[model samples]
Target: MTETARDIVMGRIRAALAAAPPERVEVPRDYDRQPLQGPADVARFAETVADYQARVLRIGADEIAGTIAALLPVGATVAVPGDIPPDWVAGLATVPDDPPLSNAALDATTAVVTGCAVGIAATGTIVLDGGAAQGRRALTLIPDHHICVVFAGQIVDTVPQGFAALNPLRPLTFVSGPSATSDIELERVEGVHGPRTLDVLIVEP
Candidate 1:
């Protein structure tokens, strides 16, 4: 067929598709359901996180501050995000988050505590960003131990579901476990690029 004839045919097909009734399309099935069983899911999630060499703790809301204090040594500096709950570190020697802390300052810090955006159950990942509870990316990277508090409301059953719950505009950091690396000779090492120890506190609402 000539080029002009092919163009005409294509235009007609496009018009026909546009003119078709919307009701002719099949409805997509619903995939968002309670994919997890009661109690079992939460237990499994904690176990999975621990299996990655990360420490996971389930605690009541009232115990948060005490737990944080215990994780950090006395007089040890801690970096806390601006939006972190004040009560979360009521008695700890926490340093308020300031912009562009020096590497020396960070190295001296014992821990960094921040709130997470979401916790993925299937992969046991914690997502964070430079948002309200989570300070700048530096806060997470520089500390030896990272204490992330994940509210139960923020936990999702699957990764796809977690993505759906996240804001596309915000910067996101996905952490599966503590930072580690292995040498060419197969010797394992920890704290190569990020915190060597990750302490996750899953707080119940």
Candidate 2:
């Protein structure tokens, strides 16, 4: 039988390992398991999210509904996940995902309102696990604009901390900023894979 290049390389690797058995070294993996305490973490998260060019509105819990109404254009049809707070969408034209809107219907809406599962301060990322407030993945992806409500209590300081708080088995969507990418000439283009505009409402802890 003829030996190939891969075989030759493997044989050499085996010979080297046999000649000098490698030592078993224990890798220290003290992952980010520290408890989350205080509101500073939330402030950091808001600052980082703003650097991505997304609008970050830090408001009082009572101001959420009115703030959202003021930010959106009048007469715009807003899409909402089934669990969105009724008071938040009060007096606004809203379509819920009770029967699950078709892709065309989602595309036609002015914006989608959702609440994220987690917010990462380190990367300015928002994670969705299709929670009742988040709806299915399609609801946010098909819409042109996303108005995500993230509570200060949901913000974590690091990715590891964020993962620690999430279920590993759930379907998760990580959004760093409004869907955008540059062309070959480096011209910025938005709404490539998801909403072109992301408006984050960061309520006080």
Candidate 3:
């Protein structure tokens, strides 16, 4: 049988690696973790996230469930974490991922709604440490749509500020808008890596 192009390339890569193994270099981590900038900019976060084609909504805490219900398709079933607030998912059909749903199971759900670990205003990024209302990384990845609720207080102005609030030991997944990729010809495709649509609800007082 003839070797495929993929196998040939992989074999050459393996041989090259065996010939000269790369060295491990120490990464520097002495940067300031304090907030060099002022307070977190909620507006900046919203603007940047919207630039990625994500839908960003600012609403009161009381309107979370209602807003979510209205935004989602009628009769949609949402996947949620086990510890998600009861009020956040009120009046919605939900399947909790406490036992950890299979990929197919998660895909069957219309969307995944969860609370985030933190929000970075500088890069319009949402971080999840699998705590609070956030299930495993799979819960958000497998579903076609993800609705992440970020509290105003959780918004940080910079990466350092975001890091200051998080525990590095926990598993972290940073999402900046919906998953999208461009091919060599610049043909844009959505949901290539994760959710095709990302709806961010910013809860304010």
What's the TM-score of every candidate structure? Answer: 0.78, 0.86, 0.83
**lDDT (CA) per prediction:** 0.84, 0.90, 0.93
Extract clashing residue pairs from model 3. none
Q: Write the per-residue lDDT of candidate 1 for residues 93-164, one digit (tens) a residue.
A: 877776667878877889999998888887888898677789888889888999999888778787777777
lDDT winner between 2 and 3, please give it. Answer: 3
Badly placed stretches (over 4 Å) of model 2 are 1-28
Error of 1 at 7 (Å): 37
**Number of backbone-clashing residue pairs for each candidate, in the order shown:** 0, 0, 0
* Candidate 1: worst-modelled 10 consecutive residues by lDDT: 32-41
Alpha-carbon runs more than 4 Å astray in model 1: 1-40
Output the lDDT of residue 90, model 3: 96
